[model samples]
Target: MAQPPKGTYEVIHQPNKLKDLVGGPARMDERLIAKAEAALADAVSKIDLAETAKDSIVKLDEAVERLQAEGAEPAGPERTIYTVMHDLRSQGASFGYPMVEKIATSMNRYLELGEPGQRGHNDADAIKAHVDALKAVVATKMKGEAGAIGQQIVAGLYKISRTKSK
Candidate 1:
C-alpha cells in the first residue's frame, strides 16, 4: 500500500523495519531490566484492573443493543465508538505487537462497515477480541520473555505518559 501522507496515520507491518527503527534487542543488566519490566507490567495491570477497556467495550455494546432494540439503525454513540476504534487502529500497529495491530485493524474495518449480524450484530465482540489479543501480548511481555522489543514499547509508553503529564 502507498504510504499515508505526512501527518496522517498509517499501519506499519514490516517487523524487520520496525525492529531496525526500534533497534535490535540489546543486552542489558538483567536485574535492572527485570525491575523496569515489573514496573511496566504493574502499570498496565492497573489500567486493566480499572476496567477502562472493558467499559469502552461495554459502552459500544450497549449502544448497538439500544439501536437494535429500538428497531433503528445504529447511530450517534455507535458511530462515535467506530470513530474511536478507527483512531485506535491507526496507532496500535506502531505499539510493537503486530498481532494486536492486525486485530485492531480488523476491528476498525468491521466497525467502518457498520457491524453486521454476528453475536447480535454488535461490534463489541470484535472490540473485545482485539482487547483480549492486546492483553495477551502484554501478559507475555510480563512473563519476562518479551525481551528488548517489549521493554522498549513499555518504556516508550511510560515516557510518553510522563511527557503528557508535564
Candidate 2:
C-alpha cells in the first residue's frame, strides 16, 4: 500500500481495494461520518479526564516510592484510579464495541471494589487494554463491505453514546 502524502487525508485513495481494514473513509457514508465525528469528540473530551487520572496515579506511585525510601507508612492518591476506570468503561460503551465495553466494565468494577494495590494494578492494565481496543478499531477499513460495515459500526456507536449509557 502507498503511504499517504504528508498531512494529506487520502491514505488510500482506491475504494475497491479495501483501503482501510475496519471500515472506509468517513465521507463514504453520512452516518459513518457523523459517528466518527461524535467518537472523536468524545475522545477529546475524555483526554483531560484520563490525563488527570493518570497524573493522580503517578503521584500515588511516587508517594509510595518516597515512603518506601524513607521507611514511612505509604499513602496513595484516593479514588483516582477508580474514577479513571469508570470513565474508560463508559467511553468504551459510548464508542461502541460491546466486547471492549464489557472489558472496561469488568475493569471498572475491579477498580471500584478491589484492594488498593489491586486498583492501581488494574488501572494500568485497563489503560493498556483500552488503548489496544481503540487501535484495533481504527487500524484499517474493509474492502467491498467498507461502506456497510462503517455505517453499521458508526450507527451502533452513536446509539450507544446517545441511548445506552450516559
Candidate 3:
C-alpha cells in the first residue's frame, strides 16, 4: 500500500441540519413547552372514554353476532372480536378507564385459550358477559379500579373466563 503524502490530508466536520433547524444544543424553549403541555392537557380532557367505549361495545356486539352466525371457522369473527378487544384493552388505561382495560384483557386471554378456532357455546356466553361488563363500566362512568365494586366485577369476569376456557 502507498502512503499519503504529509500535509496533503484534510479533516472536515459536517454540521447537523436537523439540530440547526431546532436551534441546536437540544435546548427547548420553556414557554413553548408550557404551551404544549397546556394544549396536551386540553386535548386529553376532551377525550371522552365513555363515548369511545360505547363505540367499541357496538363493534363487539356486531363481531359477536358475526362469530355466532359464522360459527368457529379458522380465524373468522374471532379475529375481529380479538382486534376490537385488543384496542379497548390497549387504550383503556391511557384514557383513565382501567376497568375497561381489565375486562378487555380478560376477554383477550379467553380468546387465546384452547384451540384457535374452537369457541364453544359456553365461550360465547363468557364473551357476552365480558361485553356486558364493558357496557356497565361505561354506563356508570367507572374510572380507575372503581373501588370494591370494580374489583369484584373484574374478578368475576376473570373467573368466568377461566371456567369457560377450561
Q: Which ten residues in a row have the lowest lDDT in candidate 3?
A: 67-76
Alpha carbon lDDT of each predicted model: 0.49, 0.44, 0.81
lDDT of 1 at 130: 45
For each candidate, what TM-score against the reference? 0.34, 0.29, 0.71
Tens-place lDDT per residue, model 2, 1-166, is 9976777564565566554664756447888889999988887555533333345335434533443353333224224434544565565455443443443454444444545454333234333443343334433312122456545654544343233221
Deviation in Å, model 3, residue 107 alpha carbon: 0.8
Model 3 agreement with the true structure over 46-103: per-residue lDDT tens digits: 9888887677788888867765664445356667778888998877867789999999
Better of 1 and 3 by TM-score: 3
Q: What tens digits encode model 1's per-residue C-alpha lDDT throughout 36-144?
A: 9998767655543223334544565565456456454545545655665554444344333444444445555555443333223344444444445445554453333
User: Candidate 2: how many backbone clashes?
Assistant: 7
Candidate 1's TM-score reads 0.34
List the candidate numbers ranked by lDDT, top first.
Answer: 3, 1, 2
Candidate 3 residue 77 C-alpha distance from true site, Å = 1.8
Residue 33 alpha-carbon offset, candidate 1, angstroms: 19
By summed lDDT, which 10 consecutive residues of candidate 1 come out lowest? 157-166
